[model samples]
Target: MPKLKLDIASKVLRLANPLRVAGYTFETWEVIVVTLDDGARRGRGEASGIYFLGDDAANMRAAIEDVRAAVEGGLDREALRSLLPPGGARNAIDCALWELEAARSGKPVWQLAGVPQPRPVVTTFTLSADTPIEMARGAVGYVDARAIKIKLTGDLALDLQRVHAIRAARPDVWLGVDGNQGFVRDQLDALIPALVEQRVSLLEQPLARGEEAALEGLASPIPIAGDESIVSLADVTAAPSQFQIVNIKLDKCGGLTEGLLMAAEARRLGLGVMVGTMIGTSLATAPGFVLAQLCDFVDLDGATFIVEDRLPSVAYRDGTVFAGPDVWGSGRP
Candidate 1:
């Protein structure tokens, strides 16, 4: 491979406003976009602000800095993949490579990535914590959506009651829950039964990441999904004892390169995969939507929170997301 040139820049995606989910509130999502120039063409990559994982825009910038010398010194995407572990660092470079290669070869990212044509995917619209009446109203507004993912933390009964009200209001809506590692042992026991009764289809990260062992030998009524609990292959082994589903995020797993591998591993373990993302614009969501091809559930609504997303955003129709017009890697058109 010829020597490649790399340039990195950081920016913030300020939400139209604050989005409160359980214990965290964010008015803006800091992101880093890395552009790889293989002399003739350029490819772009992005990263989201992952507070829980201790990744911010600054760290993402630094990560890119550490690899710039090597990346510009003729490091191809494959080399970058092996040189860096799956995480923010690899995510930027890998996506950049995909874009760079696509631009150089004159192909779309989907073609190069070998992913199937993008499909219409139904994603979850999060119901932020609020008064039962307020939440019910929000659910009622989105009643037309195929499904919803309610964010919850403390007060299991109250949360369930709120969700119950929403369910009652939208009798046809399929519901899911994400506790974000806020549930304790007793809370899980109580919430699971109610969740089952309410026909909740998924429960994400009911316990803290490392505390997944708490689920050992304990059968859950609802399909327990792992989000923060699983970041790599080691995180997948806990399937038999901890969770039946895995949530794959490019930011968390690095990029589509590792994400595909993680999804494959989860499938081999008979664990369902859910493709998720940090709230951002269509640029961020597009990559995740491609990964959603292998997932049973899709949570790529990150762009919805933005007040004004970048133009040429992913085509979202009736909860189903379509691929963007831009070729992911062939080169910025």
Candidate 2:
């Protein structure tokens, strides 16, 4: 371990357009960028905390400063978990360590993480919750999309109308619904049937975070993915009862280190694993993109939602996303 100089900067990344999800509307995302400099080599990481959880960039910056001494003292990812509880602060630092190690070891992040040779992963493009006509038009607009996820706002009739309109518009793409913790237990009974009828494949976080118990014995044909409900490694163990799939977001779980553990734990519990991201630039999505290789499903289009993305960024082509060595986890400055 070597002593390192740590630098932190906060940035506000403007969204390409207003994004309306279940519990919030976003015009921009505030992200924290952490850089680790070990003289000749440098590693950088970016993180935007879970906004719904009140994990914003200001708090993340303060959190990192609190542990600045330990980080500069050659802190490793394993020790970082105890220093900073899972959130944006830990996520940014943890990812920075991964990139640093990759640079030092002369290996790519996927290689360091023991993943097979990387491949472009097909991901779901999400449609912001809106009126039926606009939502349908949005679906039609994604000409290259092979899979689409619809954001629902817990309104039964209106949500149904929106779903049906999109389904009618793009019958060819695989469909998934993200309630963003906007639906209740009873509503899911009706909603699941309608979603199934519309050929929807995945249902994500239909209920609120503390309401996981409500889904304990509920049965459904659609695979329910735990997003807000599963934040850290502990949450992954408990997710199987409520969710068929666990969505791993680096910022939410802290970083790639915990993310890998969560994925393994979810698999051990026989739950499917998916990778997702918040509305941030390529830096925020790159670590998640590396973790995406092990996922059963991927939602790495966070960078696509931003107005402008980082250079040498991750690329989306033919409905799949990929990050070469230069984008992240390659130890490039």
Q: 198, model 1: CA deviation in Å? A: 1.1
How close is each model in CA RMSD to the real structure? 1.8, 0.9
The true-versus-predicted C-alpha distance at residue 198 of model 2, in Å, is 0.3
Can you give the lDDT of residue 273 in candidate 1? 88
Local accuracy of candidate 1 as per-residue lDDT tens digits, 5-122? 7777777777865776667888877778888776678877887846788888888788778877898887876677777766776787788777777777777777777778777788
| TM-score winner | 2
TM-score of 1: 0.94
C-alpha TM-score for every candidate: 0.94, 0.98
How far residue 102's Cα lies from its native spot in candidate 1, in Å, is 1.8
